[model samples]
Target: MPDFSFDRLRRHPDVEAENLFAVDASDRLILDEAAADLAAAGPGEVVVLEDHYGALTLGAAALHGARGIRTHQDGLSGEQALARNAAESGLAEAYRSLPLGEELLAGARVVLLQLPRSLSALDELADAVRRFASPHVRVFAGGRIKHMTIAMNEVLGRHFGELQVSPARQKSRVLIASAPLPVTDAPAWPRVARHDDLAPGLSLTVCAHGAAFAGTTIDIGTRFLLEFLDRMKPDAGSAIDLGCGTGVLAAALARRRPGLRLIATDQSAAAVASARATMEANGVTDRVRVVRDDALGSRPDASAELIVLNPPFHIGSSVHAGIALKLFEDAARVLRPGGELWTVWNTHLGYRPALTRIVGPTHQVARNAKFTVTVSTR
Candidate 1:
């Protein structure tokens, strides 16, 4: 489990009630000396948060008495962690949080950002901040040692203002803006109403804030599954798309069939945000529910009619088959006698045998050059 311990940090004299919320954050102040800088911040200030790189928000909460801050991310885990960090620590109700595509980010004098993993997300944020910030607004951004480079500085400098680095402190540094003015240019990427045509009336519009396997034009494995999913004709009942990045499969399947009550689940806040955005864009916001979850956690109900998954091969940099196997086992526990399960994976991972153990019978609908969509009948 990810550490939720903030027992030590809370004891510090300078930490504010809002700052206490950093407890659940993925930010690592344990090793870094940014704590000194955090101890220095004061009241009613606004800041912008970078994606998964969370020092700024936590720092702002800790030292600055940060108020009215704006934080956005395309990663579902990132946003969830931020919220968890805040809520579990008693700061969530106090801080202002918004997803990437939401409006109402205008009017701020200070912007704190972390360079995003997606260049598109990065560009979009920079452009958005530049448009909204006051002329003399101060833009500060940071990253760990590995990501700080001339290219990063160039990206920051071009979009916001003249950039300068703080003295290296514990393998991390803050990027301070020299001068910044409101950018007059319109954003290069705007949220569109329609993208690819999955069907005549089913135009797919993206949540532009998409990152990783969720956004890069759909995963090959998922596409393969989507193409052949109808062969099984999933029964009517509550269904879940476990690890539903952007909720693509869950949303698509639910839209195709009305009886399937679906919930899309993922641990990433960025993914959750995108899934929500996609849900809104596709006008299925009322039809499907989205959850910030881990491997389906423990299902409250004993039976789910259909469980569809395009299980991930890795999380962050860790690759282990244990979680996927656990999800399959959980599926068996929650599935009714006539329920069904569907999954697609890369060709070589050998998922069918284990899946068969849980669902009773299994077979492939179609095998593309890179993936195979499998159906397991209970």
Candidate 2:
């Protein structure tokens, strides 16, 4: 992957509001010059739409500090990435990410967007933009010049009056846009209670904004985890829901064991926020603490008795298993002796040996047509 972060930081340490929203595979870093420009913007607030890989969200935090919004495609790590960016940038005090796809815009002052990979998503975003944009909204769109396709500008033009491209520098360009017009809102996509028939007492209703794997419904992997969940005999005494994307697993855990204090942690701000909303839908938010911690970065020593996961194998399109391996270590570090670690994974990922190596002992818990679930005891 290209190091967009290093490139931006190297070339433009001097620009203001260098805050950015990114695609799933961005390589952005905080540039000192850009940081200084942000200080010049003073204390003004900015909005970041579609947080892919978390580059723009980090920039916004670096620039505005404590005033940021990150919308994530539905998944767990995207929630976790916001935390990682906040930690590496030392901007935790100034950064907060909203789960992407939720109803947002509580009077946003400015909008910063990284053109999404999908032009269809761009159409959806244009409608989202108009909700917060009046004639007064200042919008800046950033990406590599190659990413700024004509369809991309058409979406912006459809929502805002016009788009003027900034001179290409270091192979990247910015689209400066303003003036809101009457743009037809896209029909809301159906999102709540994916795949299952309505169960009067066991149904889950989510406020879904499409994006992420299974953004529109329950994902197959998640469905496997839910099926494996022994609702009647849920382990208690503190559980950690790893990669709590949209909080489905955490919510199910909460619903199954009302007394459990589950910690919802993921790499994506969207996942964290989704987890929070999922718990809230069940009236169990008070029982869970929604944390924006990377895998368990903020977890105290020996803090959890049960750790649940549907481990992710990649960071964007880059296949790096290091994150999951590191998270296994982190989970073991935070679990009490002999604490249980439960997981459901795609059968081909060769996850068992890794589980055994990390947690000391592993046992096959269950299996379905396409997946195998395991419980590792530390």
TM-score of each: 0.68, 0.66
Error (Å) of candidate 1 at residue 178 is: 5.7
Instruction: Indicate the TM-score of model 1.
Output: 0.68
- Candidates' RMSD to native: 6.9, 7.7
Error of 2 at 145 (Å): 7.9
Question: lDDT tens digits, residues 68-153, model 1?
Answer: 55676544445656665665555554356675543434555566666555555555666666766555556566655665567666
Using TM-score as the measure, which candidate wins?
1
Q: What is the lDDT of candidate 1?
A: 0.61
Off by over 4 Å in 1: 1-42, 46-114, 133-136, 145-154, 165-174, 177-181, 185-207, 210-216, 254-261, 267-273, 276-286, 289-299, 317-334, 352-364
| Deviation from native of the Cα of residue 118 in model 2, angstroms | 6.8
User: Residues 329-355, candidate 2, lDDT per residue (tens digit)?
Assistant: 888888788688888887887788998
